[model samples]
Target: MIDLLLEMFSYMFLVRAVVVGLLVSLCAALLGVSLVLKRYSMMGDGLSHVGFGTLAIATAMNAAPLTVSIPIVVAAAFLLLRISENSKIKGDAAIALISTSSLAIGVVVISLTTGMNTDVCNYLFGSILAMSKSDVNLSIALAAVVLALFLLFYNKIFAVTFDENFAKATGVKTGLYNMIIAFLTAITIVLGMRMMGSLLISSLTIFPALTSMRVCKKFKTVTVCSAFVSVICFFIGVVISYVYATPTGASVVIVNIVAFLLFWATNLTIGRIKK
Candidate 1:
């Protein structure tokens, strides 16, 4: 395993992929706990679709994908939050409406200009080779910002995630904290989309939190466990991807599925033992 990992790291592209992917995994894991608790886990999926639309437009315009996509997707996140909070659309329906619209727009733009090429395939399905040195550097910087923000606002986010009404009663700006969560999630989704794909980026923000919940009851324990699960699964997935020549994103999701099942099984066993 060490030899294989060393061999994988010998390639600059692999090194970049691992570094950026790990950081994104950490960020996703942290933010995911809140989203999962709040039942807003699919926010990542919706924002990713919006990201795809913005990326397609960027590609057609010969502009930088991340630069163009970030603001648009962030705005979409804010819109999603507002619609879910105020409009009759509400929650899953609001997510579906925006996500489907963005996805359709992305497809139309791709058909008109890029015409489903290699770059488009990479954006849709993710490719390890897609991480240029510059892309890795930018992703690292952005991922750092995400980690810092999440850590700094941990208490406020925790309060809002668990009980928005209570938090508001306690004088916490629940709306502001919720928007911050959405903002962080948007950035995390975009940072991961290059390596995880727009279609699968959300799994990073979802599976770990759910897997941890299978065993850990407390929010803090679940959060910590989610981080560990995410990082370990990502590493194992990368190894599997290198050995089997599988798609990185799909491999990671499979690993996460296995992890979730194992945690679930373990929890069941403990329950039966107590019974």
Candidate 2:
């Protein structure tokens, strides 16, 4: 396995994918804990869907995909947050509204112009080859910013996640922190959509956090465990995808699903033992 990994990493594209994927996985895992607890886990999905729409439009216009997609998706993220916070459309309903609309637009645009070619398929379903050198560089920079900000604001994020109203009462800026979370999540979704695709990117956020929560009660513990689980599963999934010629996004999601079930079973067994 070590030898295989070394050989795989010898390729520049694979290295780019691994480097960006791992960073995106870490960012997604870290933010996912709070998002899941806040019932905003679907934000990743919504942003990725928005990303696809923008990417499709970019493709049609012969423009840079990331340049076109990033700002649009970030705007969509902020829009989703405001709608959830202010309007009658709240939580999953808000997410679903943005998600379905974006996905439909993307599908129509792609069908009209690109017509579901290999590159478009890569964006929709993820391919290791999806990350170009420029994409990797951009992804790395954005992912680092996401990680650094998350660490810097960890305490505030924790407060907002557990009790937003109480955090607000306690003089914490709950709304700002929530927007920060959404902004970071939107970036991660776009970065990861290269390797995990629009359809499967959210799994990188949702699975590891949920899996860790099954056994780890503390937020810090769950965050650390989720990071580990996400990176390991991504590595395994990449190896499997390479060897079996499977879709990178689907393979990663499958590995995450297996990990979640195992953690759930372990939690149940521990509960039984305690009883």
Candidate 3:
């Protein structure tokens, strides 16, 4: 396995994919902790669907995918929050409505413009070859911003995640922080979608948080564990996919699933021993 990964690293595309994946994993995991705690986890799914629609439109228009998708997804994220706050459509209903509609639009656009070729398949299932040098550079810059922002606002985020009303009462600007979270999440989703695909990218934002929850009790501990787990799982999955010629996104998700199960079992065993 070591030899195989060393051989795989020699390829430029593989290196780009690895770099992008690791950075994305870290950003997603960091944001995932807050999203999960706040019950906004499905936001990532909805935003990824929005990214799919924007990416499809970008492809049809022959524009840069990230440039087109980023702003649109960011707008949709804010819109989703506004709708949730002010309209009858709330919570998961708003997410589902937007998610399904965006997905449908993307499919229709792709069908009409590209006729569902290998590139379309790659968008749905993911392709390591999709990570160009420019994509890696953009991802690195955006991922750094996410990490820095998260660290800068960690205390405020913690307050909002656990108790929005209380945080607002304490004059923490809950709405503004929520928007910041939404915007950051939008960026992470779009960045990840290139490698994890529209359909599976949310897994990167969800699985790490869930897996860490199985073993950790404190919020900070869970957040730390989630970041580590996400990065390790992505690394293992990428290597395994390269060695076995499997789908990269699915392989990463599979590794996450296995990690979650192991964590759950360990927690259960510890509980039983305590009894």
Candidate 4:
């Protein structure tokens, strides 16, 4: 297995995939803690769907996909939040409505323009071959920015996540912080889309936080553990995918599911022992 992994790393595509995957996993996990605790986890799914539409249009126009997708998705994130907050559409319903509509639009665009080729399949399901050197560099810069902002606003986010009403009462500007979360999540989703696919990218933002919650109760502990677990699972998944020729996104999601189950069982056992 070690020799096989070493050989796999020798391939430039695999190396680039690993690099992007690790950076994305860390960003997703960090933001995941806030989203889950705030009960806004599905926001990632919604933004990813919007990203899919933007990416499809970018592809059709022959533009740099990330350059076009990032801003549009971020704006969509803000719009989703605003609609959820003020519009009569409400939260979950609004997310479902926007998500399904964006997905449909993406499908229509792809059908009309590209006629469902390998590139479309890659965007929908992900492909290791999709990661170019330029993509990796941009991912690194974006991931760094996300991490820095998260750390800078760590305390404020913690307060908002736990009790938004109280945070607002104390004048924390919960809305701005919420926007920050949305923006960071939007960036993470766009960066991850090329590797994890529009369909599965949200898992990276969800599974790590939920799995870590099974064992850790405190916010800080859970955040740290989630980042570690996310990176590890992504590495394992990429290796397995490369060795066995499995779909990269599906492989990573499967690894996350297995980890979540293991964590749940271990937590249950520990509780029984304590009792």
Candidate 5:
């Protein structure tokens, strides 16, 4: 076991993969709590598609995919927030529309430009094995920014999540907070795309939060537990992928699902025993 671990840790790529995975997991766990509470669980899905579309466009234009994706994702996030304020189009509908459109655009653009390659598969399914030092640094920077934002607006975020009207009545600028949440979501989705893929990125935002909520009642407890769970799953998944020569993103997502199931089952059993 010790030899195997040392072997896994010896490679620079593996080390980078681990760092990126941890950063993505931490940021996703933090943002996911509010997403679930606000019933915006699908927001990750939307932003991921937005990221994918931007990536495709960037590829076609010979630009860096990350650079292209970030601005577009942020803009889409802001637009979503604005649309939500209208109250005419429900949040779910808006998300669905935007998400589907963005994904379709991505698919069409890729078809017209690159004609598909292994890179497309990697992007769609995740490519932790392909992680570089630069990717790790980018993930770290994004996570740091997300953490700083959360710390700065913790109270206002708490209020918005629990009681938006109360926050608005108290002049908390709920609209701005809503936009900030969306922007953060976009950033998380973009960074997460490489680790989790456009297809499974939502799991990073959903499963951890769901599993933590099952076992913890307090909001802070949920965040702490979820982040812990996310990191565990990420590391375990990377190890499994390395050992089995499997797709890292899929492996990580599977680990997260297993954890979610275990938590959910345990909750059910305890509830039955209580009864």
Candidate 6:
């Protein structure tokens, strides 16, 4: 165990991996809080597919995937928000349509691209082993931006999440706030794609929030606990992946699932005993 720790610390790639995991987890936790509260838990999944589609197109054009994907997904997020507000299409239905379309487009684009091994499986499932130093730095910057935005809009977001009608009554510009949340969700999905992949990235945004809400009674407590749990789960997943020679993203997600289930079970048992 000591040897593994020392080795992980010694390697630059391992350090990058750990840092990327931490930053992505923090971003997911922050966004997860609002997502869960708003009952938009599937938003992450939809944005991730949009990110994947952008990545595929970038790969075909021999451009930087992150550069291409971020802006596209952000724009798509705003469009979705507008559609949600102006049309009768339900939020989940909109998300489902977008996600399915993006995934289909991504798969088709990848197939048409020549000389690119389009590792759809890795992108779908996740591949922490593929993380680079640049990716880590980008993750850190993206996470910082998301955190800053969340802090700036914390009160409005709290109001909107709990009661949109009340927020609108209080002159909170609920539509604009919802749009901002969607924009941030898109960015978070793009940033997290490398660590969690398009398919499983939503887990990072959902599990920690779910676990924290199960145990914490207060909103502030839930936010803090979710972030803490997210960090711990990411680290554990990375370490376990290194030790077991498994895919880092899948391993971390599995760890998150296990942790969530354990906490949920404990919460349920305690509640029953209290009764």
lDDT per residue for candidate 3 within 1-275, as digits (tens), equals 66887799899889989998999999999999999888888999999988888889999999999999999999999999898878987878999999999989998999999888888778888888888788789889999999999999988889889999998987889999999999999999999997898899999999999999999999999999999999999999998898889999999999999999999999999999999
Give the least accurate 10-residue stretch of model 6, judged by summed lDDT: 113-122
Per-model TM against the reference: 0.98, 0.97, 0.98, 0.98, 0.95, 0.95
Evaluate residue 80 in candidate 1 and report its C-alpha lDDT on the 0 to 100 scale: 91
Q: Candidate 4 on 1-275: residue-level lDDT in tens?
A: 77998899889988988998999999999999899888888999999999899989998899999999999999989998899889998888999999999999998999999888888888888888888889889988999999999999999999989998999998899999999999999999999987899999999999999999999988999999999999999999998898789999999999999999999999999999999
Could you tell me the lDDT of residue 174 within candidate 2? 85
Which candidate ranks first by lDDT, i.e. highest?
4
Candidate 5 ranges with C-alpha deviation above 4 Å: none
Question: Cα lDDT of model 1 overall?
Answer: 0.92
Steric clash count of candidate 4: 0
**lDDT digits (tens) for residues 140-243 of candidate 1:** 99999999999899989889988899989989999999999999999999999978989999999999999999999888899899999999999999999999
In model 1, state the lDDT of residue 201: 94
Global lDDT of each candidate = 0.92, 0.91, 0.92, 0.93, 0.86, 0.85
Relative to the true structure, candidate 2 reaches a TM of 0.97
Pick the winner on lDDT between candidates 1 and 2. 1
Better of 1 and 5 by TM-score: 1
Error of 3 at 50 (Å): 0.9
> After best superposition, candidate 1 residue 220: deviation in angstroms?
1.0
Candidates in order: C-alpha RMSD to true structure: 0.9, 1.1, 0.9, 0.9, 1.5, 1.6
